[model samples]
Target: MSDRRLTPELLLGAYAAGVFPMAETRDASEIFWVDPERRGILPLDGFRMSRSLARRMRSGRFRATLDRSFPQVLDGCADRDETWINGTIRDLMLDLHALGPAHSFEVWEGEKLAGGMYGIALGGAFFGESMFSRVTDGSKMVLAAALDHLRRCGFTLFDTQFLTPHLASLGGVEITRAAYRARLARALADRASIDAIAMDGDLQAVVQRMTHTS
Candidate 1:
């Protein structure tokens, strides 16, 4: 193992290898690497949108955009009682975002940010780091947008890193590490981009594309 430091290059390499960094808590001084034996992944082809959520999206009460507010989105994700986003991780993410391997998806109601998610993209794989919602179903809405965006961009893998009941409810599943590595390998071999999808800040397209894909 290397006494690794966090940089855009190292971070992307870690992701391509099916490993990631985390802190024990928001205040932790050191970052640690986690390569779980069981990895959680959300398949691009299997993203599920419940009927009510789909209705909310179709109604167009909220709007969605990509890489619009990377910093705010990261802060939102780390704004919890306990978090893994320490100062070091925050700085590393900011640097990565500036370098284009990172991306953010935000849901909005008028001028207010309702919810958002931020993650890293390497080749055809997207590592969904964290998310936060300030309005009902906000995070979920952003997730739907992200799924549609990735699918349109020709992405093959979406790694959530771990599963929560919230994620599992929306088609996220766990695979053995070996399975994850195989999927990761395939994704790393392909090429994709967030902009490869024609999102164009169209909320309706977010719903329509997801519906068509799912």
Candidate 2:
């Protein structure tokens, strides 16, 4: 096992090696390493946009942005009860964002923060840490937009770490640790143009490409 120093660079290094850190609770001071037996990932070309979800996205009811309000997004994800985002982890997120590699996809309805997500990216790999939603389908919208951005940015592996019903609804799947590490190594060996994502953050365009990709 690594030293688990919890610095921004150390965290990135850990992610590159296919492990991540978490805490038992929001108030916990210590962080622990997590390398699950089965890793959860959403196939870049297999995101689902059901009729109802499609309808909401097409309606243009919300807007999305990247690297905007990162702290808020992190806070939102940690707002729930029994969160793993302790103060140390939160500081690491802030530090990582400042040093680059960490990013957020924020969704807003008018001036209100509706939903958002944050994660880390390296080469062609992206580690989706957490997400939150204040309104219905908000997190899904953020995810759809994120996938499009990732695809455009040339990212190939979207690691979710764990599977949940919410993630399953969006085509998240579990793979053996060995298979996941294989994919991770491949992704780390490749290069992806992060600049291709730009700052536009358009949802309709994302939805349009989703059907064509898979």
On residues 1-214, what C-alpha lDDT tens digit does candidate 2 reach at each position? 2224667888888999899999888877698899999999999888988978878877787888998899999999999977999888888898889988888999888889899999998999989999999999999999998888888788899999999988998899999999999999999987885567485556676777887776
Q: Against the correct fold, how does model 1 do in TM-score?
A: 0.94
The whole-model C-alpha lDDT of candidate 1 against the native structure comes to 0.87
Q: Residue by residue across 88-161, what tens digits does model 1's lDDT show?
A: 88988998999888889999999999999999988889999999999889988998888888888989999999
- The segments of candidate 1 whose C-alpha lies over 4 angstroms from its true place after superposition are 1-5
Give the CA lDDT, 0 to 100, for residue 131 in model 2. 94
RMSD of 2: 2.5
TM-score of model number 2: 0.95
